[model samples]
Target: MRKLSLLFSISFFSLYSFSQSGTMQYSGGKSADKAAVLIVPFEPFMYISEIDRQVGLENNLDGKAVKSEFAKALDLYLYQTFNEQFQVLSFYFMEDDVEQDLTYVYRSRKLEYEVLPEESTPKAEEKLKGIQTKLSKTFKKEEDESAYGGQIVTERDEKNKFMNAIISDQKVVDSLNNRYNASLYLLINQLEFRNVYGDFTQMEGNTYDRIAKVHYTLYSRRGTVVSKGLATTPFPASDNNLESITSTYFPILAEQIFNAVNMDITSTKN
Candidate 1:
């Protein structure tokens, strides 16, 4: 009898863990498949020291530039993944927004500027800016077709520029709902990336690694968070390089998140 009880306990926990792999607010069945989701540009957090020490990027400005490049790449990857699952509205400055850039993401009401270097050569500054521009243009060719089904609306009147729609605000939600009439607005507050050094038993060999932890909140038209999901994607030990590993696993991680959060709200309707 004791052995049977132990086996049952193990079986129960295995099922529970699989269900809980993707974070969910309230659970039961899946939500409407047609529900539109506004996916904002992913805000990124990367350890500066890791870039400088491990990646051999010494200049803080250069480190920040690399950080910016990764942010754009992550945004593109996320939009591409989510676009496949839901009708997505985006405020990604690199590919979508008309005027706003990183400055807008600083979000005026919550503005925090990076300190300018105390002393820097003009040549260095110019070089960094050049690299930034080049990297910005690199991802455009990757998209073979437009998922939005129309030419991207790029030309906007100046009066509507500098939209900080990337961050969650009642006004932003209301505006997007007014425009796209999207049912849910997903605000990704942070996509934290950290370097993992050395090998683990899962795969052998000393190598650098990374983990992408996405923290997101989903709001309804009433300005309430209907659901929240967090996805932490770790690189498989076999072949771990930041860019390559992320590209391979991000889709799977995103699918996991969608499965959990896309859960039918009907099950919890009161």
Candidate 2:
């Protein structure tokens, strides 16, 4: 009985260790003479705000569930990219793991109408009466004596538009450096999602597509930006899974970071 218990414990520990070992190596790169290149794993801090609800999905899913999927996807991407040349050091930071005084801006704008009407003369009282009725229905009518008999239009636009929070602080940078022991850091500056309209003359069934655009920057220990990159990818409107859409661009981003690091290391040596 004692021997069986010991064997089971050893087996469980071995499996646990194997599961935890997340490293990848890339072939073809010059043999590493020194292990100076340390890659702090990519931390997904941008996904935190949506913790309570599902992102881009009709069904609501908690942040904890989404994180596991993200980890699996990220691990797969890193393994494919590095495959024998580089090693993934550790899963250092996650969105929920650290405290951040960060703010984000999400701007959305829609042109209400075409600016083609050029009428020099104001259409007088008759048309104005009908316009007033329509405006009243659409907007919360306010009485302001300044405008032609105290009428004012205050309402949300037919085309919804808004600019979200803006996050910027020196503390964020300092905290990142202190926690990771990394001299360089990466920041995801912009992530935009839009529906693009197009002419169907080219042969598509639908006249519009949903696209995602990402902009990011790399900063050195001195807070100097070393490099920046942008990527745009399209996703089918039917598949409104935000996680899936975002994961599509991860490889491109990982590659960009790898190339940037390679260049920096080479430049320093020279």
Candidate 3:
């Protein structure tokens, strides 16, 4: 009886280990304990307070540099954080054909990678037309606010649209899968830093409560969405020092995003 119990224990342990290893196909059928994830290049969008903007101007700071630094920092922290949960992360740049060894590729077609407000204005017009059809011709257009379309498309919306477009395009999806052999694809769509303390124009403190919003989408090899949302972290606002922002704020943002991804994965499994 004891011998039979020992045999059963061994069998259970082996099965557990096998199950713990990644179930998805990775790196040409090699067994991976963690899911292989492919990350798209980071796209950043900044809407800083007037005070911060002035600070940036005084310091000769530009959005491009800040965006690039944040991208690298987030990429590094993401790998470090996700490494605890999985391994095999890589990056893919849509405009660049050269492949890099970094923990995040080539692209066939050039993508604008942005959705301008003008592009979505036509859809609003169509909707208005439909409503007009339901009403009488006498419905005078009183300078429709929708025609102005002040709706700010948030990062979350942008990510959704971008992911949907990519998923529908079979060629892009297939090409990535062939090259990366990764089942999970993550795109860091946009990052935003907002001043949470009073009006943007009136804020005059050296440090104020600020929130960092990171929008992302995680999809499967078949384009099935695993997780999609914005991860936000609050920090004390400071100067636009690249090193300061990276070292102080990025890890916090990374941790928040990591928790979000991990939660989603667990929820999906359940």
Candidate 4:
């Protein structure tokens, strides 16, 4: 009887560990045929360092330009890498028609800033302008060391809650399933870039490593949550090295994201 009880305890512990791992596969046979995933591009939500230690090509760092380039490159590499295991569905083709206006929530934390949806209207654009001013002011006041700190864990949990609501919308799920027969859904939540050396107070020169965090969610066709986590990678920090960053670290981040979900599925099945 003790031996049997010990076995049962081991089983419970294994399942508990799986739940905490931030990756999961639907144990029930949801899609028996094959893997087909539809990826939503990253929303315009980012947290970046405001320091001038790392100089750009023009000796000025443009945060907007960096965000735009990284968003596009990350999306491309993600699709390419995941296509190896699944029939990747491109949502970029119909982006404008399906796109919703976004409202920005600025936070001085790593991956805590949010770009949530609002109705498409002139007011939305006006509101965004105000938010941009606020973000700029906040960034201007922050140093690299303390800018992305002072975050409570609940902040991220709340953002994930909001993300869950978006991904679990039945109407959207139904539309995608009907239109593309997509069995899996991937949503890029947010991204952040930070310099490796935290203390900018004693900086000698310009060179440093830049680390990126790509937060994402994966769900089943029925809007059942599969996995949600962040994939991170570091590259040589250079403001003018967008080409190198795209060609190198983007692929690494993509592969990390893919393996995060794929390995979970494999482990759960076995």
Q: What is the TM-score of each candidate against the true structure?
A: 0.49, 0.41, 0.57, 0.58
Clashing residue pairs found in predicted model 3: 90-104, 91-104
Runs of candidate 1 exceeding 4 Å displacement: 1-33, 44-62, 94-169, 196-209, 236-242, 264-270
How would you order the candidates by lDDT, starting with the best? Answer: 4, 3, 1, 2
Error of model 4, residue 63, in angstroms: 4.4
lDDT of 1 at 136: 17
Candidate 4 Cα lDDT to native: 0.50
Give the per-residue lDDT of model 4 (tens digit) for 109-144.
123334434321123133323322111112232333
lDDT of 3 by residue, 162-228 (tens): 2211345566667667766677877776565544444334256554455565656677788677876
**lDDT over C-alpha atoms for residue 226 of model 3:** 80
lDDT of each: 0.42, 0.37, 0.48, 0.50
User: What lDDT, from 0 to 1, does candidate 3 have?
Assistant: 0.48
Name the regions of candidate 2 deviating beyond 4 angstroms. Answer: 1-97, 100-175, 200-207, 241-249, 260-270
* Residue 256 displacement in candidate 3 (angstroms): 2.1
- Model 3 clash count equals 2
Per-residue accuracy of model 2 over 42-81 as CA lDDT, tens digit each: 2343222211232413324334434434444444454445
Full ranking by TM-score: 4, 3, 1, 2
Model 1, residue 119: distance off in Å is 50
- Selected candidate, larger TM-score, 1 vs 4: 4
**Best candidate, TM-score:** 4
